[model samples]
Target: MPVIKDTFGYLQDDRRVDRITLSHPRSGFSVEILEYGARIRAINFPHARRGPVNTVLSYASLREYELDTAALGAIIGRCANRTVARAHPEFQLSCNDGPNHLHGGLIGFGRSLWRAVACVDGGSPGVLLELQSPDGDEGYRGNVSVQMEVRLDSPLSFRTVVTATTDRATPLNLTLHPYFNLTGDPDVSIDDHELRLAAATYLPVSQDQIPTGEIRAVDGTPLDFRQRTPIGARIHETDGGYDHYCPLLPGSAVAAELSSRRSGIRLSVSTNQRGIQFYSGNSLAGATPRMFRARVGLCLEPHGFPNALNEPTFPSIMVQPGETYRHDTRYLFAMTQD
Candidate 1:
């Protein structure tokens, strides 16, 4: 059985909201999620050296999360990343991200409250977070039902499965937004983290930070993560520490791996999504009173490419009626040898 606990009390628009935490005792892994935004409040892992510590950046109060410009530990939905804009009024979306519709516009899933419940799937214990988006909500046409299941599967592994069904065809790309730091210390940066990716091709973004409809080879660019390398080795070369999508190569296999020598913790990421957005958290920190600073944590969001609604050559992100949209991501944690 999963150990469930009531966390902080959040006051949003006079509604008293509460955060819930589900933990696996044997693995020493815990995930805290909030009703507001169905967002992850914190992900606590057993540090090989530092005892139990939260690996993801987060805020202590709901007020800080209310002002969170960065997605933080949230379930980004309606669409995970940025959406395109057309000159025609009929095709225009909310301009929240400086002319783009980011994370489902101004009041996206990250800022909205969700219906949450505790559930046990099979023999594994988890939490089911649900949300119903009305037709035309966030400029999308459809009454969409989104469900996210966060499961703690015993020692050193957790799973996130996001599914949605809509009455109308619409762009539906859902993904996780967790700025992770394997190191238990919040003061230290993730520049020294060792990362390796199985992906070989990546989507190049324009100056506007939107994918340029180009799927380029990673062999010669700084986007290459085929071999294990220090994250900061070429981060300075990117516009602001990698924020582009790396489409997973053919076959069913592990997508990426991240390890930290400081804490002896290793995180292996596996996903079924076509694209993974690697962000170095360049624009993080300073947004909240929390310990959020640039370069401190990194996010690996696996899903469809950003602006896919407008890009034809990119992977299809349309969720039509009678069809189910599903994406699954897993994080396997292990302790490195001393």
Candidate 2:
């Protein structure tokens, strides 16, 4: 396993972006990342029979969306979810209340430039992208340091590990936002895809799309995806389509699984987070007409409770001084003929 670095591309605004490539020869898998927030740019999985490699997502096209700072396939953090407008004594964070603080304030880890530190662990290849933010960078107190590791274990698995430390007490929630397309067809809608989430209840949101702090049962609701079902089956029944956080049932370790019946592609998501956000990409305003429609691509964001800062009863997002914040999420890919 070897870690290699190279210059990727610079935004028109004159920000430098670097690329890291990690390869696992045994598994015939490789991954590339852009140094901007250490975002995952592309993953290549060799066919089972040693055929041409199949790309999971459009890595190059992602740059186009970078114009708006979409943070595509980047590690988001400081606070992964929304925070209400107010101050919490324990966490020492102030919420604007105007809208929930999303993805670590507006300029989250995704938008920040990270220092690339290339390293290999034993025989495993990976790179650690580090960023240190001064206190109040995003209206949060305390200086925060974040390290994001992108590892290529096999062609089938890409692991993301995020760890952070703060000098003063603050709120911390972090997660990766990867836009996946198993079929490699960006224009194809995932409506026909089947998904199963290991959850019984979900947090409902208000008209403004902020969590109402109420945990509602998923049974008999469009939010239910406990069993395998087509993504588009109940999408229209909901507001613009699913965007709420699904709370996993007790003892459920496997957060969710998605499969493309046509491509025989399967992705199993494992996480320690308390909630999983099933975003149906309802807000995808693509530039081209051939781009997939809303609800075409789905996001299974493993994270802490959404709007946690506003709801006192929810899991605490506090990160105190001298304490380290850590979260691990894995997306394992496999192929089946079913």
Candidate 3:
């Protein structure tokens, strides 16, 4: 295993951006990351039928990635999801999504540059990226330093660990946003992918797509994926496509499982977070011709609940001085016969 580093592109300010690749020759598993947003450029894995296929949605050039609004394969931070307007009287943030804040405001971590370096973790090739957010960034109260390590844990598995520390109390939730197309083809939608999640309850949303602070059982609703089911099975039943949060059930180390029959590729998701956000890529609009349609990919985000700052009943996303916040998530891939 060797780590390769190259110049991706230059910013408008002429700052050099780098691209790092970690590859396992034997298993033919590779991951490409960019320093611009600490984003994942691509995840290439061996397919049963195809020689090697990229499992995540990616743009053609750095400019396309810079203009990406869907986040694509980037790291979202400061606050991963929406934080409703007026959520807190003391904390006022810039509203990017309608009247509420989405994915840490307009110039959030996902849109910022990070310093990255190649590293070795447990004899595995990895990249360590760090970003420093100044005080009053996006109207937050603290100067925060965050470190994210993307490691190739095994031939077919990759893991991410994010740790942060703030000088003042701040609402912090970071997660990697990667649109997965298990079929490895942008023309093929994820509608046929079979998915099962370890969730018994899900948070209901309001007309604005913000959580209503009510937790409902998924037993009879279309949100229920306790059993393996096709993504398109009950997608039409939702307002748009699935863009809800499911609280992970306890006692299980695994959070979700997704498989594509066309490529015979399966993905297992595991995380230490309390819940997972399942997005069906309903709003995706890619510059590529084959990726112009929605539902071409989907996202599984592991982090704290959305609008948790306003919901007292929900888990806290607050990080105080001297306290370190850490989140670990892993993605494992395999080839399945059926």
Give lDDT tens digits, candidate 3, residues 1-338. 45888899988778888998888756868899999889998999976567789999888788877778888888998888888866798789989989999988998998899988546633478989999999999888899999999988898999999999999999998888999998888878999999999999999998888899899999889999999999999999999899999999986688999999888899999999989999999988653333458999899999999998889999899999999999999999998867
* Candidate 2 pairs with clashing backbones: 29-155, 83-101, 85-95, 85-97
List clash counts for every candidate, in order.
2, 4, 0
Model 2 bad stretches (over 4 Å): 49-65, 86-98, 121-123, 286-292
Ranking by TM-score: 3, 1, 2
CA RMSD, predictions in order: 1.9, 3.0, 1.6
Clashes of 3: 0
Which is better, 1 or 3, measured by lDDT?
A: 3
- Which pairs clash (backbone N, Cα, C closer than 3 Å) in model 1? 37-112, 285-292
Computed on alpha carbons, the lDDT of every model, listed in order, comes to: 0.81, 0.73, 0.88
Q: What's the ranking of the predictions by lDDT, best on top?
A: 3, 1, 2
> CA lDDT of 57 in candidate 2?
38
> Model 1: per-residue lDDT, tens digit, 36-64?
88787787887756778788887878888
- Residue 293 CA error for candidate 1 (Å)? 2.0
Worst 10 residues of 3 by lDDT: 284-293
How does candidate 2 fare on TM-score? 0.89
At residue 222, candidate 1 shows an lDDT of: 85
- Report the Cα lDDT for candidate 3: 0.88
**Per-model TM values vs. the true structure:** 0.94, 0.89, 0.96
